[model samples]
Target: MAEITTHQLVKEFPGGVRAVDGLDLTIADGEFFALLGPSGCGKTTLLRTIAGLEAATKGRLTIGDRDVTELPPGKRDVAMVFQDYALFPHMSVADNISYPLKIQRVPKSSRHATAAETADGLALHGLIDRRPGQLSGGQQQRVALARAVASNPTVFLFDEPLSNLDARLRLEARTFLKRLQRDLGVTTVFVTHDQAEALALADRIAIMKEGRIQQIGSPREVFARPANTFVASFVGSTPMNLHTATVSGEHVKVAGSSVPIPPSARSRVSDGDEVIWGARPEYLRWSTEPVEDSIEGSATIVENLGAAALVTVDAGGTLIQLVVDEDDEPEMGARGWVVPRIDRTLLFDGASGELILDDTPTSP
Candidate 1:
């Protein structure tokens, strides 16, 4: 296994566009890490650079204490599985999985034996003779993964490998991939624009934007304590409710209603300084009447998601979403209340998108 590191990595293209700028990463041996961000944010560029497919304009890469910055992809001891699976329609599953071993000139008998074992382990034994054209999308992806693992490379790289599958297949593939990583203990680095995929599979994730890393931490750390507003908003579904407001004495006014700001929140800001407030839908509740830490609004939409319903309310002018039990869903166009759980709220500096210091109050 290899621990990969990059220092001050830079990548430039024609027309002087810098796709990746001063990026640094440290991935431990046998750890599953992910690079997550939206498209054009330099995620794929960074991954390709690590794979040696694209040369870095500047910086150094080391794998297990060896400097490999200048090595070619084949010589770097890394195998990459792409979004398209990159399988040949003409080759059977067994042939494709054995190709990596053949390239390294492994004994013919040994390669065939290893291929059969890998196919059985991946539950693809019965489909070994089938070509990519004859298999379903999920089955084809498994073949691609089986091929990468058969290489026995120290590092396994995935670039949106499940993007082509449907929702159900994607979930199943996610489980398969996670289990495979743990079972093989391969040092893996996967890149995905989907936040949920990152949260689900990664041991730790590095969230990126505009060619720079926003934050790197475990999924729970990133979600519970977002480094900034962008991360808080990007990581969750239904989006966090953000409201701008002024602080005066112990009161904060929203839509001309003076709601008492909790003591914990008051200590974070000075008098008259603006702050952005955030709360996830799950931490909010609906009520029949306006109350403390609450906003009155008209129900705009109600979406049933099996066991729970997502309620969208138009509060004066702000649209707030609330996650509630199925029994509590309000009818659309009905008057409702928005009660926020202050303890679960997040505060950010409006100008810099940075998180502000807050002393969370203890619940009685």
Candidate 2:
């Protein structure tokens, strides 16, 4: 496995649309990294660029110690799995797995042995004789992965490889993929628009917007201490509640109430400063009775989330959401008080939307 590095990498198309806008990145040897963002955010383009499928407009790219910026895909020593599992319809599973070895001109006997071995390692037993059209989606995906593994490349690149599977299979494949990567210790870079997948699979993630990375950190760091308003809003499964308010003495006035400044961030703002006060629904306390620093509100919407429910409260005109246990869910039109955990809130500059506190507070 090899580390991948890019310095000021840029990919521009006609009419000056820069799909990968001067990205600078490094993936440690054997690290599982993910490029996460919404569609058209250039994550797939970036992955393709790294694969040498889409040429970088400018900048240097290196795989391990080799300068692969100008190399062709075949010469880059990288294996890539596409979203559709791109297997040959006419080829049986064994042939599909051995295709890369065939391309490398390995002897027929050796290639088939390697293919059989790789297939077994991937749990593709009994299905080896079946053609792509005969195999299930998960099987085909494994075949694609087996083909990639047969190459024994320096790095692995995945382009939403699980997107085609059903939810259950996707979950199973996700677990399998993580284990496979751990067992192989291949330096892997995955691109996905699904934040949940990225959080679950990546050792570290780079959240991008408009082709530029907004933040790069471990899943927990990105989720708990987002670098700015955009990150706080983008990374969470439940969007953080963000409210525009003016700084008061150790508090922010919003929704006709004074919400305490997250304890560690209180000194970051002064009286009369404008800021965006934010809190995650899961970190909020909901009560029917009055609570200190509570925002008085009435439940306007309750969204079922399996064992929990998301209750959207209309406080004055601002809506704040809280994740309540299903049994504790307040009925629609019920008045409630929303209290943010004092140490779990965030403060961002109102004008720039940049996080203002250097020390992001954490729950005790």
Q: What do the candidate models score in CA lDDT, each in turn?
A: 0.85, 0.91
Task: Write candidate 1's Cα lDDT for 1-364 as tens digits.
Answer: 4999999999998898888889888999999998998899899999999999999999999887779999999999899999999998888898899999999999988998888899898889799889899999998899999999899999999999889999999999999999999999999999999989999999999998888899898998787667888888888766777777666667665544545565445677777777777778998898887687577888898999899999888878778888989988888898867887776776678689787756564431
Poorest stretch of ten by lDDT in candidate 1: 255-264
Error of 2 at 316 (Å): 0.4
> Candidate 1: which stretches are off by over 4 Å?
255-266, 358-364
TM-score of each: 0.94, 0.97
Query: Hey, what RMSD does candidate 1 come out at?
Result: 2.4
lDDT of 1 at 168: 96
Q: What would the per-residue lDDT of candidate 2 be over residues 1-364, giving only the tens digit for each residue?
A: 4889999999998899999999999999999999999899999999999999999999999999999999999999999999998999988888899999999999989999999999999999888888999988999899999999999998999999889999999999999999999999999999998889999999999999988999999999888878889889988899999999899897889889988887767767899998888899999988999988989999999999999999999999899999999889998999989988878888889999988764545442
Model 1 Cα shift for residue 187 (angstroms): 1.2
Q: What is the lDDT of residue 231 in candidate 2?
A: 88
